[model samples]
Target chain A: MLDQAFETLKTYDWGTDRNLLNPIDEAIVASQADPAARRGLEGRLVAVLKTDVTRAAKDFVCRALMILGTADSVPALAALLAEPEQSHMARYALERITAPEAAQAMRDALPKLDGQMKIGVIGSLGARRDVASVPALAALLGDTDTAIARSAALALGAIGTPAAAKALMRTKPTSAEAASAVTDAALDCAEGLLAAGKSVEALAVYKRFAGEDQPKHVRLAATRGMLACAGK
Target chain B: MNPSTRKISRRRFLEGSAAGISAFSIVPRHVLGMGQTPPSEELGGALIGCGGQGPGTVGGMGSGIRMIAFCDVDRRRVENAAKRFGAKDVYTDFRKLLERPDIDVVAIATHPGWHPLTSIAAMEAGKDVLCEKPMSRFIAEGRAVVEAAKRYGRIFQIGTYGRFNASRDPKQILIHKIMASGLLKECQAVHIKRGGLKVAEWSGMVRYEVSDPGDREWDLYCGPAPLRPFHAHRFGGTHRGYWDYEGGGLADMAQHHFDPINWVYAKDATSPVQVEASAPPAHPEACGMWGWVELRYADGLTFVMDSDEWGDRYDRQTERDVRLEDLSPIDQQKIREMPDPEPLVGFAEAVKTRQQPGGHAEAAHRTATLMHLANIAIRTGRKITYDPKKEQILGDAEANRLVNQPMRAPWRVV
Candidate 1:
């Protein structure tokens, strides 16, 4: 039954009947309780990626891996991370995979990709809260492309470490878009710090923006953060 | 008349005319005072996602609000809504609309995927929000929206009003009091919400051709969700069918039913400890039909949602209502002496008084969590053991990951 489903998947494309993939779906559900069954299913799914399947077929497999894939499946998924048509779907699966190697694969792809592809990889890194990639992400804060720089700033904010906060505080944005991203990211770091019980550190981050020169809304957020840090 | 006295009277008349004109302009009521806004003092308002529900949400805000802006990913929707509301400002991007300081209130009827980001951004910009329900796309996003409301001192109300109606019911108030008193250590009550979940109606289209989203910012519309090829089914109201944007009909309609149930059961502050569902394995992208879901709270209360749209009916728990008999005799006596719960504040009143609304952020988050947890169970095809306090799934890393699903980058909830 699984072989028949895989054969159907190989020809699957947009506008094709999805019911043809039902056997695979049934297997995924049936294998949830049996670890051996799950690993077996994962192996079969990963094997399909190495073949010349349709984009829709690969998309379906990646979605399944999001729920069932383990470290053993990472290499096949990571291989697609630099392919423009496949990268987002690959990240969709890798972002949810809890294995450290999945994140490493994404960070490794950063230098090989650019444009929206690079931005997408940066996003996956941030989504994983990959602290190891912070310095690499911080370096992109000054990239000439505003969108890439903005994404990097937001990614750093999503990481929300003290180091991420310091990187944001030390840099001045050359573009309005990046400046807004920086403010949003700094606030995100402070909120994260406060939630982690580092009130003094959070206060320092907030105080950086709580000045008359800042926008009214920014000042308001900073004031709120300061008051929260003081336990008011 | 003397020349000097006549000139002074003319100046006074001009000042009074200016005040009358200003009364019709957009000034937030809170800035005026804590008192009810005068009939003439119109609050500035904006509508996001100006599709089928956006204009309706704006109209529902009562005549005290003057529509100032209309925003939608689709230019056609934005243009249509702007013309209908006589709004001079229209934008395809919500971020630009949110920047207007004069927009005292924002009515968000966007897809659930955009709910948390738009709500949080609006709150941070110092505008009160009336967001459409189910309050978030995921559990963590809902909690973030709640925190932003508190952090920024903003008023937030989910679109559903069932809890307001429940708060007005005398019997419901009694059940609320009994449950909230926490004296009933063992609750054996069973509450069931049957049928009308629209499971089949909202089940997603599994196969559709990618099409152009004419005049729509397709990437912006995807927002925190993965950027997928644009298909008509994935746009507008039909967007409810996809997990990428929403949790299907259950998410589309659950809040209306669960909001009041959560209020009466005093489950607004916590969540069910275990959830099991009867359904086919859900499609990873498109939502599918589900038979039923049984959620159990730690206190022995069972809340069952039977989607009469599929399979066998859920008959494990007899249909019944909470009774005084469900509580211990001592606890019953204590509840009888307790006062009725306070009447819930309406959104408009809450916005004026700076008080929490009936369907405030925390309660909305809890209600939305019930739907999310049920969907999680259906998708995983397993019984989920959850920790209500920590908001994590026990002994299951994959299931726990659903509780705080990662948003696509540049859109972190934390």
Candidate 2:
């Protein structure tokens, strides 16, 4: 019955025949409340993803995996993150996968992806707060692709470890895009540090932004951030 | 048409029952394995707005049912969405889309100005509505839509999910403490986090040319907004920049950031008694950046929109509101015993069960009120007084004009 239900996946569309997809939809909803069923769904989805199928069919399976996916499903989803057609849906699942391995997958795929796909992977790293990807992400700071470098700067801020903060601070932003992304991230890093109660570390990041030479908005943010840190 | 007084035919309730019969084809909830018996019927939804945040809002509701109809002024957008979402019915007018009796739910993700009017119309047509935020462009209009939803007994949700999608943010926890502890009588600037100011202003800053204004349905697109020649900037993403259609960023971000404050204060049934802003003078035709604004409830609780400048100390105020060291054991235990915020139940589930979604109409309206009031305060450059019960701007003639704006020919906010 479960196998039969998975077969309906091939014809699934966003706003399509509900009665046709009921059994499969039930399984997806049911899996959310039961751990065993979640793992079972994950296993079956991974298997289905591995099979040769229409890209749309695979996209359907990936959506289900967003709620039920485990580390076992990450590799299959990761492989699709660079394929232009499937990359968006793949990244959507991986971004919410809640597994470290999903973060690792994006990091591993970074070198091979380009344009939006590459930028999407870098962004997923930041969203996941993959601290371990900081060094690799830092390298993209100097990349000729301004969008890629900006994505890296923001990702490092999201990672928000002292090391990530240091990397962002060390880089001399070359373009307007890079500068904006770095400033946004710097504040985020300072915020992350302050939230963790490492006021000294937070202040260190804020100080770089507080100088008169800094842009007015960044300077204003840094000055306020410094007060927030000192108060703590 | 005075939208406030527009009557729903008794036939709609009859249609509601008729809709019930065909609605059972919904995805069976039994699959989720919760203890409750699963409904065999699925809810069918329709999209009334096909541009900007419309698609994403529909997408985020997750898949349980399908939206069979798609509507937009832009034919290209409507058709593209129809292909992408498997929508069978497409139209340029929402009234035409509402003719589908099979549509059990409607997602009105149109511009902010249209939220109240579209939602009221959908409810009158016996459809549950999930409207995008800034429930109305003005306070009085929002109140009318809320009344319409109540009168029609329709399930209505606003697009902002911040209040419902509660998480364990430290600031939220502290705010909850202040609420549960009843220490808010003297509270001022007692809540704060990234408000009103982005460190780096991010805008498209792209020059928008109409390309060929006559080629698009410009008149219909401007529905209820003042009659004006089409400018691409006045369309999609840049609509927030103009006061003719929306209240700018404050209105746009109101539900996202202010809903929790409303939830804590239970401010839905009422609104701020006073709204004051210290921003530079605002533009008559467009919106600009605002400085800090204070939304003061009748009870002395002030919701401060913090500025970027240093020494605002809004965070310090929140900290001072509840320090664990300062609290007695009994008080601390009271804080501890206060229940954690429940996770937001899904909207699809809410529709199946005939209950409210996390971002229900009342809360969304009250939160949206804050943004509208701020805009009024900034525009008038004075501390404006508001009477929540009257739903009117108090004693300020010019400000009151904005409280209930007159729509152009062939449209009314009633």
Candidate 3:
């Protein structure tokens, strides 16, 4: 019956029935307690993806993988990263998988991909908060693609480390768009620093934002951040 | 993205639903999704107050769950929020909002005083409630809300997540560390310090200048409260500084601070036995800032909130302190493993499963009552006794009057 549900994903029409989601959700919850069941479900999903599948079909498979995917599932998802249509869904799944191998898969895909696909991998790496990827992410800050640079900045911000903060500063762009993204990421990094109780470092980040050139909101936030720092 | 997706899921959900889900069967079939619909299954709802907390609160519920109707006394707020959230139906009257049969839930984002009217109405209409906290303006209204929730068997969640999750607020983190260290077990009373630089203000003055005061449907906004001309401060921002709409800063921020404290101490099932306050005489129409207040339980555990010192202190009545090493290993382990609470995430989970959210109605009511009673003591300038079993203020006429405050028209406490 569960396999039938998995099969439905392959054959189901796009707008036909939402009830198709029921069995999928049921399987996800059921897999949580049963290791054998989880293994079976992951295998079924990965196996289905191996077939010539529709984008929507792969999307369903990726959604399921997000719930129950493991190290074994990373390679199949990584293969989809170069396919623009599937890259988004693949990252959606890969980013959430707790397995460090998913992070490795994303990091490995970095040098081989470009455009949005490369950016997606950068994001997944950040989502994974793989500290080891900092240097690689740092290098992307110098990339000519402003969007790419922005994404890399945003990803490093998501990673939120003193090292990430320093990388952002070292590679701080003069372009307004890239600078804005970097500063946004810096604010996030500062927040993370505060959360982890690196107050001095956080205050320094806030001080950077307190610069006269920064926009009003960022400056106001930086001012508030300094007050918070002083209060602590 | 698909209409058939919604229809099929709704039908499937009904078909899969168990014949009955008793109140005692707290783990409803919906949660397991084994024979039920998934979180991805769309359940529509309405936003009752669109101006303040409504939009953000609804946003946190995710894009999948749609708000079909929007209600607010202010026409501008309604039109703006409806357009912003893509809500097709808009009404100034919340009762009209409740009349919609399609709304599976109603997010009551009005001021705390109006909470009772909207929440009870929604629950009675078979809609689950997501209410902003200070669950009720008064103790009586809170009791009514809890009763309505039980009678209607609807999931009622107060919007405060302090009881449900770890907070990012510095003050909350301070409280969290204290709880994690096993310092919550009380010998007797507590004394709070006035940590924040700015003291709470209870100014009811409509200081800000506004061009169009007539834009709001003033009577609808007032609801059961005393009707008056719409002022910027009266209905919208800083309304918590007023007595008619809310119970000042303590009441406004009460659940945020106390809900988690109530949970950590297992005090959700009951209320304080007595409350006393030290403050300047409260104005008849405006809530005033309070100085020091004490809440004493029947078990002789006491809590004193001091605006002077600004930090929590266990009253050195009996035990000086029990360090981490002094406590039993079980409690220590429990503290160490105390689970992080998810707020909106849990609400979505509960909606799918029909279980109680972490910050459910009963706990909210208890915490609100704890805060409200302090306000009651401060206002009346007397120590007030409460019978938690009877759910009433005992032997104090003014305090009782405050709890069972009169309503003007078109609404009555259930």
Instruction: Place model 3 in a CAPRI quality band.
Output: incorrect
Rank by lDDT, highest first. Answer: 1, 2, 3
The DockQ-derived docking category for candidate 1 is acceptable
DockQ of all candidate complexes: 0.23, 0.01, 0.01
How many clashes (backbone N, Cα, C below 3 Å) per candidate? 0, 10, 8
Per-residue CA lDDT of model 1 for B1-414, tens digit only, reads 111222222223223332343244435556776555565566899999888778878765655788889999888889999999887799988889887878989999999999999998898777889998889988877877876675455778988888888888888988888789888788878889999898998885764677877878998889878766788888888999888899998898898899999999999878999999999878767899999999999998889989999999999988666788877788788888988888888777666556668888879988999999999998888899987755668888777667766555456564
| DockQ of candidate model 1 | 0.23
Cand. 3 TM to true fold: 0.52
- Residues A1-232 of candidate 1: C-alpha lDDT, one tens digit per residue: 7789889988888677778888898898788789999999999999999899988888889888888889988999999887877877787788889999999988888888888778888877876778999999999999998988988888888787888988998888999878878887887777777766677888998899899987765776677677666665
Q: How accurate is candidate 3 locally (lDDT)?
A: 0.68
Q: Between candidates 1 and 3, which one is better according to TM-score?
A: 1
The TM-score of predicted model 2 comes to 0.55
TM-score of the A chain in candidate 2: the value is: 0.89
Instruction: Measure candidate 3: CA RMSD.
Output: 25.6
For candidate 2, write residues B1-414 as lDDT tens digits.
Answer: 112111122122223442443254344456666553334455677888899888887865645667789998888888998888876689988877876778888888888777877887677566878888768898767875665554344677877776654444666665656555664454443455455543113121223233456555787777756444466777886787777678766776756788876776556557889888776545445666666677778866677776564234344234224344445677667777777756555567667665556676766777888888888887777789998766678786446656765343223334
Cα shift from native, residue B326, model 1 (Å): 5.1
What ranges in model 3 sit over 4 Å off?
Answer: A1-232, B1-40, B166-199, B204-212, B309-345
Please give the distance, in angstroms, between residue A20's alpha carbon in candidate 3 and its true position after superposition: 70
Ranking by TM-score: 1, 2, 3
